[model samples]
Target chain A: MSAPAPKALLFDVFGTLTDWRGGVARAVAAAFAARGAAVDAHAFADAWRGEYQPAMERVRSGARPYAQLDELHRENLDRTLARMGFEGLFDEDERDALARAWERLPPWPDAPGALERLRAIALTAACSNGSVGLMARLARHAGLRWDCILGADLARDYKPRAGVYLAACAALRLRPEETAMVACHDHDLAAARAAGLRAAWIARPLEHGPGRPAPEPEQEWDWIARDLHDLADQLGAPRP
Target chain B: MSAPAPKALLFDVFGTLTDWRGGVARAVAAAFAARGAAVDAHAFADAWRGEYQPAMERVRSGARPYAQLDELHRENLDRTLARMGFEGLFDEDERDALARAWERLPPWPDAPGALERLRAIALTAACSNGSVGLMARLARHAGLRWDCILGADLARDYKPRAGVYLAACAALRLRPEETAMVACHDHDLAAARAAGLRAAWIARPLEHGPGRPAPEPEQEWDWIARDLHDLADQLGAPRP
Candidate 1:
């Protein structure tokens, strides 16, 4: 805040600010219940997400055709549903609806407050893997107030790529010093930092509902907060 | 129409949508006149743009460190101005103002009509090498209405790169098939096609102001128009 101030704030979506897991589980639960199946969809939700990284890596490394999260999510869900003894449990329409269920995830308790705080201090934008259209619908569905959205679909490369980070900088017409990345995941922060962006952390303890494993933050950060609300408090931003 | 509809339209900024050359020339003309200088700024404007690709490519290929278009513009302007005998005619403050002249770029005459039409048909977003912050400033400066902005700073790579386009698609939650790239340049559309996006050609014959080279479409496109007004006409979308 002294010399080179941040002109914008880039946020990580998913668990940091939204309850994607809970949303997925709820959608799956309803889908199964309507189908008169007793499948444990909560477990299915966790398992499907568990397979996410590997599936994306396949596309990332060119092990498979260029595939999107929507397609990858569908493929994994289909295989997982069959293994869970829910064969023919749903049709194409149901499957498509479930795939888009991630778009309807609920925002975390502090998301609104944090976004307001960030916006007050600087422009707030989303830098996520979700498509721009998906982000818009998600915003509408979850009532997120993002000034704009940036995702892998925009840069054609996933996070941790400097090009991805740089693309956001280009669009904002800001130098790397002018932007800060706020994310729950440390790896993303590390990438942003490596690209010369300042970093802030908003811890999301139950990103995967406690059972699923996620990488923990190891590096020291410019800022650390219990939640978006805490960060807002520290930043002296307006309360949502 | 049988396919999943595009939820958003991602537009190319520079020549395709906005007349960067004309705008920059006007900015140069105004800046020069404001400083009581009698130089032909229009020539410098043409020469300045000529250096854009090479400078960006230097970063893209690591031949040079990453520099924003603004920085690059200043660098090129200073060199070109000195060469053109733009001596003590302008001071540092005037020079800086001239450098930011890019920010005050005017949209092509067709921009308002086309954007209005696209807005009625789908959410409209700008995908350009201009930074997100730059685009935002330009939007306010030019009164261009965009749902959002995406660019190199937003994604890191330049136009021919897929990051921001993919990011735009992800942020919009729209598949490549569900979104189309709109631009006056063929290289931009070609890249969009390679990424599996549909394309719209919005031609601007006067972008180079008479003698400069312009691009030609190399691939089959979904639609082509002489200008934004024509593009809007084909879509049957009305101006706001």
Candidate 2:
């Protein structure tokens, strides 16, 4: 049976819309070079991102109350840098600038055009773990047009939690059945489905890095497409 | 002395960016006409809006907990229609369509161009009391390009309250000093200033109706201009 059309499309921004891994690595490398330090930037980026879930887990597990992704990002960056023996290498201003790297992520090749197309037919928004400020700045930098910013900060909970998906639907005044969660990760789509939102999976082979195994659709989704362009086509958004 | 440059420009949508009175009046008149009811449409529009503040006041005064503007607007519409001796004149679907007239408000003459220009230099968003869904639909219908939606629903409080203004600022991760509240109403600007945000007053003499006294600047706002276009020029946004 065909799934119903969505009134709104909630997007996972980091891996799906923007190349966060590549962008973060590049920014960290520049920051390190400026401070006269040589470091494995790619490894540093991965390590920092690797800390993402565990940090959010603290909040999810109630070990810590909700803190914005920006705050968690900075903390993760500090710990990652410390483990790499680069602790205190950058001062407060430098750290602030580095923490904002997420705001300057580059959009994937198909993201901007596809998003513009989809937005013409349906309400589109960022439904990610990023804070509202982080998502807004990233959208500004990357030209990702969103009707509204809906993120972990707004829900006061991280993704994979029911609150994040439900909050995005609530903010749009849409039922979960009338909203689709589009993401690259299987876990995200699974959680969205569990929360009653339709799921559309888009594969990003290089999301982790080159030579890594490309993500395949492991489970059925409402719609699975190769990329956002394909997803837009499935949704019947006019081609640009 | 010149005020600091604003990092973000938050707008009051109903009267400031849109001709709500005119739009609502026209829509209501059409609904009445369709029902073969000879009602004074303009007066109906005014009376409907007249209940706006008092309904919000109940929420603001702790007499009622937070309710979305959509809910409040519907309640007010029902009371107004009943008082006009047209109780149950329309079915649920008809009432819903009429209520959605708020979502189709037309933008003022200079609003689109001025907002486009200003957005080039600063983050721009709707900071009205409208719910996110309402603002998003209005923006789509009116072709108002907002970077993100912000308002009462996010704050769970109505405007003129500290929480409403502060919530927008907090969502954008901006200090009140770095954000400007742009509105046609003196009371809105005054409330914004009291909450530490810079305020810009745009004169909309016809906001209530033609030939009605235009509001003059009652207090020293950060900037006072004839309209959004003039405000954009003052802020040095390149004329489009």
DockQ of 2: 0.77
Docking quality band of candidate 2, CAPRI definitions: medium
> Residue A53 in candidate 1 has what lDDT?
78
Instruction: Highest lDDT: give the candidate number.
Output: 2
Please give each candidate's TM-score: 0.70, 0.98
Per-model C-alpha lDDT, please?
Answer: 0.76, 0.91
Whole-model lDDT, candidate 1? Answer: 0.76
- Position A205, candidate 2: lDDT: 96
Q: Which pairs of residues collide in candidate 2?
A: none
- Predicted candidate 2 versus true structure: per-residue lDDT over A1-240, tens digit per residue: 167669999999999999999999999999999988999899999999999999999998889998888899999989998899999899888888999999999999999999999998899999999977888889989989989988787788899999889988987888999999999999999999999999999999999889987779979999999999999888888987
lDDT of 2 at B134: 93
Where model 2 places Cα greater than 4 Å from the true spot, the runs are none
TM-score of chain B of each: 0.88, 0.98
Q: Which has the greatest TM-score?
A: 2
Candidate 1 lDDT by residue in tens digits, B1-240:
223336678888877767788888888888778877776667778888888888788877767765667777778888778778876677788788888877788888768666877777787888888766667667656767766776566556676777657766755666787788998778888888888788887767787788656656666678777777777677777757
